[model samples]
Target: MGVGVRVGVFLPAAGFPGMDHGEVLAAAVEAAVAAERAGFDDVWIAEHHFMSYGMCPSAVTLAGYVLGRTERVTVGTAVSVLSTCHPVALAEQAALLDRVSGGRFRLGVGRGGPWVDLEVFGTGLDRYENGFEESLDVLLAALGRERVSAEGERFRFREVAMVPRPARPMLPVVAATSAGTVRLAAARGLPMLLGMHVGDAEKAAMVEEYTAAAGDLGGPEVAHVAAGVAYVADTTREAVAVMEETLPRWLGPGLSGYRPVDGRPYVPKDPVEYAGLLCRLHPVGSPGHCADTMLTTIERTGVRHLILLVEGAGDPALTIRNIARLGAEVLPKVRASA
Candidate 1:
């Protein structure tokens, strides 16, 4: 048996039509708490606002709530959009969450995926990359150092100090992909969280790329977390059939960036075609199959931390059942054999 890997749950609290907002959020909370009870190591919440896909507008807020509710597992924002707010304010919120959580808070910041929120927030599209980079610089300085200073294309500040500094080490960056983003993370001496959309082959290559990038930057070894959909059922046939039925609907506009072969976004086309493509990127099968897939993923990606981004179908009951199965069947086996 190899050393076990860290597994975390990515909370997807939806605000679908006809569903009360409170109920959706409550369901997500219950699921997260169950995952912790299932012996998961962390719970991650993604930031999305005014969207039916994900009702949660504030990952930090939800993270704090989760931390307060749970005792052991770390709670973190899968990513908080960096360009959406001032660096100091984001830093304070993160640091305060850490303190409140008794150092069980992990933060992941990103430039954010596509949405109309940029215009809504009045952050123009032009110079977005520059602005995001600048924001990250300022954010890292504030979290890691007592005094923060920055002069950049989007922001300019001088020797500002964060009043409530982080109690633990500053949180690592999540949702960092692309060679450019990996290089940035390496330069900052932080780990990168690879997206769930990535396939095993791509994940392995990315690990290599990140390692080389860190070496070139004369930085420390760069740790990384791999993420993807995971499910375990009584039979492989049942699991695959279930995923094919539920996942296409689950893959909405939010996941348009998860390009399959031909390097194009997966449009809703032939159901069979789309499902096949999604399967290439996800793991869904019997317990033994899921365990084998996870083991192969770890071997290929060299990532010790694995985040199960999707559980059961949209059905709440199925979601909870899958979590239980993962904990009871797959998790123990993986730990013993990893």
Candidate 2:
């Protein structure tokens, strides 16, 4: 089989300095176009509600907008938190987007963030996993046009037919999960989008568990394992500098109410510490080094698809250049080695 690495740009609304909302959107759209031109196979957008970090709260809407601009690139939701929205609404929106994109839409779902987001939605954190499971069942049944009637603890859906079915019968549905949710994805035979932002050891354990569970489920296609990381500049020093400058603002006191580890916030206080953490989690280095890192990661984890989180670096232009560099210098070598 031919090897493919799907590179995506994560669009965050919170601009670095000297950039506003309109500027950020414009820059992100430009970057998406650049990614397409640079030969990246697919692009995925994220969903977050009431967070300055994620501008696109509605991923399907943004994917529709991006679909209008690009011809060949596959657009998808990196992880639409299923617990927050009604399954029928999400199904209808995804179906419409799939039609608009001529079947270039992929669906990625997750249980969502911890307590803070749950509070915003008036949902208890304890119900996150249950809500996700119920929502997924509703969504899949709706998409398949199955007469769904369920009276679960979290959701109750009567016999209903969701209109505007997706153009493709079997649209790829990926489960975005960490260690806690990996087994669920495997047991259900869903492809996994592994979060690489969590440390390297965690990522490795997650991959290992996912692979073993997938094997138990009859060895289905090894189900695409895509890992993501915030890729930065040409050198280790520049990468650390970028991380140092952006981490505090990105994970500032706005999130103070959330529970911290040992009274320290979930985010790191020192830039160097954060940078070291990111370096372990992400493949941040020169293009050649990054390529080698990706290859090694693929060999170790057997992940077929890779999503590089380039927008975290705080410079749109630099992010675009890195995309080009990765497409030109990184992907080819990786493919050749494969």
Q: Which candidate comes out best when scored by TM-score? A: 1
Worst 10 residues of 1 by lDDT: 255-264
lDDT of 1: 0.74
Candidate 2 regions off by >4 Å?
A: 12-14, 122-126, 170-180, 199-201, 215-220, 230-234, 253-272
Q: Rate the local accuracy (lDDT) of all candidates.
A: 0.74, 0.67
RMSD of each: 3.9, 3.4
Model 2 vs. true fold: TM: 0.85
The per-residue C-alpha lDDT of model 1 at residue 330 equals 87
What is candidate 1's TM-score against the reference?
Answer: 0.89
Candidate 1 structure quality by residue, lDDT tens digits, 132-156 = 6677777887888988777777777
Candidate 2 per-residue lDDT, tens place, 1-338, comes to 14454455555443554557677676777777777888877778777665456666777777788888999988888777776777777888888888878988878777775645665666666557456766677777777774556687877767776668887764345555555567766766777777655644555677678778777662536546455555546786676666666655554532332442123247524544554676666667666667777777776666667776667666677778767777776777767775
Could you estimate the TM-score for every candidate? 0.89, 0.85
Candidate 2 achieves a global lDDT of 0.67
